[model samples]
Target: MDLRIIWFWMVGILIIGYAILDGFDFGVGILSLFARDEKERRLHMNAIGPVWDGNEVWLLTGGGALFAAFPVVYAAVFSGFYIALMLLLAALIFRAVSFEFRGKVDSSVWRRVWDLAFGIGSLLPAVLFGVAIGNILHGVPIDASGTDVGSFLEMLNPFSIGVGVLSLVLFVMHGAIYLADKSEGDLQTRCRTRASQAWMLFVVLYIVMTIWSWIGSPFLFENSLQNPLFYILFVVLIGAIVFLPIVLKSGKMGRAFLISSLLIAAMLGEMALSLFPRLVPSSIDLSNSLTIYNASSTPLTLKTMLIIALIGIPCVIGYSVFIHYVFRGKIELTEESY
Candidate 1:
């Protein structure tokens, strides 16, 4: 296989893994904002407590994979999106600390403060991630030197913000499904209700975003449409999205959650297919855009990395699977719980 293509898919898998795993963690945190009381808040926190950190490792590995496999793209994205990435880092730090410190104090005020931090921390990253991807999909202002010529505020156009809102809704729904899966009693019922609401919101926003992308980001479909298989995938994507709510309403939390995860994977898959060859397209100079051929490492280097990945990735997957299997049940708050 062409290592560039292989690495591209590998990197995409790592990102999808992060989105599927930490996506729900971020979702849990976003949902935590709506908790009725400290008990409800703790239920939200503990829903993801066992797996959030482990989930983050996929992102770290994805970064490393990007840096190693596609150095030029890494340099361009990291430097061009420096401020955005830093904000994500800051939010992640604050969010992680909140998990530990929120339970340290029994005071309602202290818990409330951490709750606020946790919610904002989780929410910002989800919105910003979509905004960044929106910019990528919309094309960034990359000059000859591959610098983002656009100002920071310039990055926040209506389309990008709409994409951000779409992402937020998606995460909220994803988190709701997870909460429904991992919570109990009134909280579980409330989570299921929230999931249904989030799903309805997602359908509306998904339509709007689809219209926007069809108009503004038409390139995403142009190449993909050349292949008939893309249409099959789209059908599958729609089917999964449609089937999710039915399963949720049936009180099958595990099945609903599985469908949600698959739905996320399908969405990511579409993005990957649409974004193939070009990692980041440029608005200022199309020729300056980073592509797999222009942005990747040498073939020998890629082969070595693949060998390493073949060994390392399975270990990561095994470890992640093990963690989930160990924690596979509704959360019960104990002295040891978050």
Candidate 2:
């Protein structure tokens, strides 16, 4: 197999890992904001505190893979989405800070401030990430010089906004299911109820976005139709999402979470299939678009990275698996809890 394709799969896998892992992080944070009391808030925070930072490693790994394998795409995307990425970085930074500071002061006022920061921090990234994906799918103004030519705000079209909303709702649902799994008593019931509500909202948004994507960018569906194998993945993705609520209602929290995670993987898989060969589609001129062949580094570089990744990625995965296994099951808060 070509190293280019190998590296592309590596990048995609890392992204999927991040999507499944950090997704719940945002979900928990968003849910925490609506907690009825400090104890409930503490429960929410503790539910994720053990694994949230570890989940972030997937994100970093994905970015690093992109930089190593497709430096041009990395540069083009980062430079184009400069402001948006900065804002995301800011949110993540402050959110991390809130984890430590939210409990530092005994006063309710200080905790409230940090709690708001955590929610906004989590919310911004969730929406912005979807918007970024929307812009990519919708195509951005990229010059032949391989640069994003549009303004930052230009990424906020109606299509992207819709996608952003869907992302937010999707994460909320994911987080709710997680909380429902890890919590008991009234809190567990609330989590389940919120998960149901989020799922309903997600179904509506998903329908709207799918329709909009089909109408606005018929090529997404058309191109998928051209690929028989990928079309199957598309079907499975839709099936998993549609079946999510059923699983939730059946009291299968673990299976429900898997379904949501599968949906994320399948959706990304579909996007990868749609955008295969092309790295970033140029709105200015389709000819100016970046492709795997056009945007990737030298074969030697790719080969070297593939070798390193084959060794390192597994270790990362092993560590992630170990961490999750160690932290598995319900969360219990104590005086020392975050």
Candidate 3:
């Protein structure tokens, strides 16, 4: 296989890993805002407290892989999304601070403030990430220099906003299922109810987004339709979407959570399939687009990184699995708990 193609899938795998992992973390934070009281809120926080930071490692690794494998795409995307990236960064920082500070002051007011920060932090990233993916799929205006020429406001068109909402709803649903699995009693019931509601909304928005994408970017579908893997992933996505509600109704929260994660992975997989070869499509001129062949680092560089990744990625996967196994169970709040 070509090194560029290999690196492309490697980058996609890291990103999908991040989305599946931290995605629920964001969802938990957003849902925590609706908790009935302080104990409930703390329960939400403690539910993810054990693993949230580690989840973010996937994002860091994804970005690093992109930078190393496709410097041109990294430079262009970061430069184009500078302000948006800054906002995301600030939100994540505040969210991290909220976990530690929310437990500190003992004052209800302070806790509330941090709680709000955490929710907003989670919310912004959920939406922003979707918007970014939407723009990439929809095509941005890039010049011959491989720089995105579109403004920030231009990035938030109707389609992009719809995708953002879809992302937000999906994450909320994912989070609710996870919370349900980790919680008990009234909170668990509420989480299940929210998950069902969010699933309905996700289905609606997903349909709308699909139509919008077809009308706006028909070219994205051309390659995917011919690819057999795309069909397989699409079937998995549809199956997950259909079975999630049934599983949730069966009082199988853990299975529902797994299905939700699969749904997310399949959705991203489809997106990646659609965008294969092209990392960032150029609306102004297809010739200006950054693609796997044109944007990737040299062959020797890719080979070096592949070797390094082979050694490193498995360690990450093993560590993540070990952490989840150690923390697997219902939430048990204590005086020492965040």
Candidate 4:
């Protein structure tokens, strides 16, 4: 009913959309480094090629929504996390170049460089994204004017670093599961093994980070738990985590991968729920925090954007689904292929 709540849903949907879509693409890149050979790596790349760029549209929309609908939150977040965001942007650029140029250059040396770039690029975003979220959860230092006046070092604390690694590992695992489902032969087996290994590490890291995050900054969990919906989302996430390994071990790769995607969605949903109202949690006081009320655009702007988004998002999603369905199944690297 309220424009503020509408804006909240709009931003939340886009944020989750980006995490679910680009997330696997990053995972594919992580797996590329461990692929058995060039051909295997090519298969990994091919599996994501048809939709990777399209998947990125979700990210663009998410950023656009923030800038349009919630300018204050956008300003504070982008400025506070400017350095980290810049690094992420750079990594994304390198990743795009690595993807395009890696195949064009026939030389092994050139391809190797791209390969390394791809790995680093994937890793940096995965880790940094988690850290960014972690920092927000921990509450960044804000001044009397409600501006994000925190130092760079303050953002890179131990808690954020732990969350960063957790993000990287989680996405890598997510990618591996997708590859196993879409690929066959030696590469598929390798992906499964890698996914299994990543799952083990992810479980350990996720638990530790969750506990530490709550202990170190109880407000994140406490605020979230105050809402019944938050607990519901948490249960769904936990269930997905429990369900994934069983599906994988049962040799249902497709189902397992689908469940993995759901798990990612659930986890992101939990974080969003945890951080609701406060876009950038203030370490100082609740009154100083940037909530949906303080951060959103005017009601007229919000209403206009809502109408446009309702029309636009579905079209983008429809096309993405169409392409994904058309390109469903394992990628075959033939001489005729791009």
Candidate 5:
């Protein structure tokens, strides 16, 4: 296979890894805001405390891979989405800060303020990520030089916003299932109820976003329809969606969480299949699009990077597995707990 093609899929896998691992962390943070009391809120935070930062390693790795393998696309996207990315950065920073600072002070107001920060921080990224994907699918106004010339506000068009909401609902559902798995009694019941509610919303938004994407970005369907892998992923996505409710209803929280994670992976896989070689489609002119072929680094650079990635990615996987293994099972809040 071509090295560029290899790196393209490699980058896609890294992104999917990040989305699946850290997605529930965002969900848990958002759900923390709805906790009935301080203990419940701490439960939400502590559920993901150990693995959250480690899960984010996939994101950093994905970004580094993008920059290494597709410098032109990286440059174009980073420059175009500068302000939005800054907002995302700020949100993540605040969320991280809240984890530490919220526990330090005994004051209700201080903890409340940090709690709000954590919730908003999680909420913004959940929406923004979907919006970013929406814009990429809907196509951006990339000029001849391959830079996105569109204004920041243009990124928030109706279709993109709908996609953003869809993403938020999906994450909330994922988080609720995870929380349900990690709690017992009243909290678990509440988490299960939230998961079911979020599932309903996710279904509605999924249908709406599909229709909107069909209307706004018909080109995405063209390649996807022709690819056999798309059909396979589509089947898995639908199956996961269908079985999620059944598992949730049966109180199989772990299975429900697994189904939700599969749902996320399948959805992202569908997006990758639709995108194929195109990294950033140009609204101005399709010919100006940045594709895997057009935007990739030199062959030697790709080869060298592939060698490094081969050795490094497994280490990340091993560490992630080890951390999760150590932190597995229901959360038990102790004096040292977040």
Candidate 6:
């Protein structure tokens, strides 16, 4: 097997893992904004408190993998999406600060500002990430030399905006399901109702976005259509779609959330498969796109990095599981507890 191919899948897995774990952290933050009361908001916050910061490690790993395995693509993407990337970083910083310091202050007004900041901070990155991926799918308008020639404003269009909205809705729904699992009493019930209401919207948006991506995304559809393995991926995607409603209707929070996770993983996997070899698809032509083969570092570097990943990923997973198990109960805040 080609090492390039291996690195390609590894990067995809890293990103998907981040999305699955941290996506809920963002969702919980968004939920905090509209929660019934301060205690309810705090419950939402506490549900994710222990793991949210740690969840971001996957992103760092993914980025490092990209820089090590596909340096050219990383450089190009970072440059092309500089403004959006900066915005995401800012949001992350503010969210982290709000999470840490909101309770440190005594004034209600001061804490309220932090609360709102946390909500917006979390919300911005979640939506913008989807938009960034959407832009990738649609193919950024690069020049003849395969470089970014358009301004940031030029990147924002109907397709990318739609994807941003779709991602926000999906994650909010994901968080609601998680909240239902981790909370009790009024908050749990409310979260379930919210999840039920949001699930339909997510379904509609995902379907529409998928269709739009298929028909309108030159980079995604064109390449995938040419691949013989595309049919197999298509079948798996269809299966996930069919399985979703069944799982949701089953009303088992664990099973339903698991299904959601699977659906998201499958979708992201398909997207990666569709653009296989190409890390950043060029708007001009497929030939101009950044492929793993063209962008990869030396074999020595890749081997060393993979070795580190082999040792590191398991440890990370172990710690994550341990933390979840340790805190495995509904978040309740009594006067004394708070």
Which residue pairs show collisions in model 3?
none
TM-score of each: 0.97, 0.97, 0.99, 0.96, 0.98, 0.93
lDDT of 2: 0.87
Candidate 5 per-residue C-alpha lDDT over 122-212 given as tens digits, one digit per residue, 9 for 90 to 100 = 9999999888888898898899988889888988888888888888999999999999999999999988999999999999889888888
> Model 1: residues >4 Å from true position, as ranges?
none
Off by over 4 Å in 4: 336-338
Regions of candidate 3 where Cα sits further than 4 Å from its true position: none
Could you tell me the C-alpha RMSD of candidate 1 in Å? 1.2
Question: For all candidates, what are the clash counts?
Answer: 0, 0, 0, 0, 0, 0
Judged by whole-model lDDT over C-alpha atoms, candidate 6 comes out at 0.82
Give the CA lDDT, 0 to 100, for residue 179 in model 3: 95
Better of 3 and 4 by TM-score: 3
| Candidate 2 lDDT tens digits, 152-232 | 889888898888888899889898998888888899888889999998898788778878877876656656678887979
Question: Any residue pairs clashing in model 5, and if so which?
Answer: none
| Clashing pairs for predicted structure model 1, backbone only | none
Find the number of clashing residue pairs for candidate 4: 0
Which lDDT tens digits does candidate 4 get at residues 122-209?
A: 8788888788888887888866676998877888999998888888888888888888888887777778888888888988998998
Pairs that collide in candidate 6 are: none
How does residue 181 of candidate 2 score in lDDT?
83
